[model samples]
Target: MSLLINIQYMPYVLAAIVVILITFRLWKWKRSLNYWRDRNVSGPTPVLYFGNTLTALFKPFVYTEMEWYKKYGRIYGVYGLVRPALTVAEPALVKQILVKEFHKFRNRMPETD
Candidate 1:
């Protein structure tokens, strides 16, 4: 026995794969929504796979953070897809660093290893 394959059906296979991918993405979105709801931290409703903003159509930093500070009142929370993010309004901490001649400064993460 021999089997024959038709290239015409390839489009259907591709479409099915696309549909599956979209469905899985939606599932992850819904899961994130529920997680936020449980936390009770208020935020804007997400736009399907856009995650609360039109990041795809418009770049994330299209408008400077200063503009956001004006609208969101200097401080508001924003999420990147499924990740949680915080926008700070004021920098309450002020530390002065003085370097004389050959002083080197090292940058480190707040989470300290």
Candidate 2:
């Protein structure tokens, strides 16, 4: 046996797929809201969409890092346009990641390696 569907329903199917994709993205975004809180890290409150991108852009990146470090202590969290990012102020940890274990980087710069 064979089955066939009307061509007129194609648009509806496509629209449903789009809706599903959008809904999934929104759900994922909302689910990430508690990431830092769950981890016990603290940082500045984020704005609607820009997050810390604008502050990082206008002022020197180090200044922003310092501000968050002063406020939140050795380790803190920030958002880069809704994406959670972690900042570590510990020099030893930074040295370990940049030098001792550089090979573990997923996207290591070709010039650096």
Candidate 3:
């Protein structure tokens, strides 16, 4: 009798777990969407899950980047599959990161055996 009762309630429990997972996924997606906006950065809007990758599929990557550069200016944010990427088009900032801040950005790659 106890086993039967548990089996009868299994579907409800599974449904509740599915609902919780979906809600958590949506909350995370919403947070990712606002990542750049919270930092006062501007760029093209991203779609759920895909981000801005779809734009590249429809247009040439170089042309797409150029269009974004013209629209968003030297510094803009882009999403690559839910991760936010910062593009620095300004030469001075690029030099600062590559030269003056070389020590700080030097550990970008992970060491491997």
The global C-alpha lDDT for each of the candidates, from Candidate 1 onward, is 0.57, 0.76, 0.90
**Model 2 per-residue lDDT tens digits across residues 1-113:** 12346566778999999999999887776667557877888888776456678897788988888888888898788887777877777999878878988787555434422
Q: Could you give candidate 3's per-residue lDDT for residues 36-82 as a string of tens digits? A: 98999999999888889999999898999999999999999999889
For each of the candidates, the C-alpha root-mean-square deviation to the true structure, in angstroms, is 9.1, 4.8, 3.7
Rank all candidate structures by their lDDT, best first, as comma-separated numbers: 3, 2, 1
For model 2, what is the alpha-carbon lDDT of residue 42? Answer: 89
Report lDDT (Cα) of residue 28, candidate 3: 98
**Per-candidate TM vs. native?**
0.42, 0.60, 0.86
Record all residue pairs in model 1 with backbone atoms less than 3 Å apart, i.e. clashing.
Answer: none
Find the 10 residues in a row with the least total lDDT in model 2: 104-113
Candidate 3 global CA lDDT score: 0.90
Listed per model in order, the count of residue pairs whose N, CA or C atoms clash below 3 Å is 0, 0, 0
Name the better of 2 and 3 by TM-score.
3
Q: How many clashes show up in model 3?
A: 0
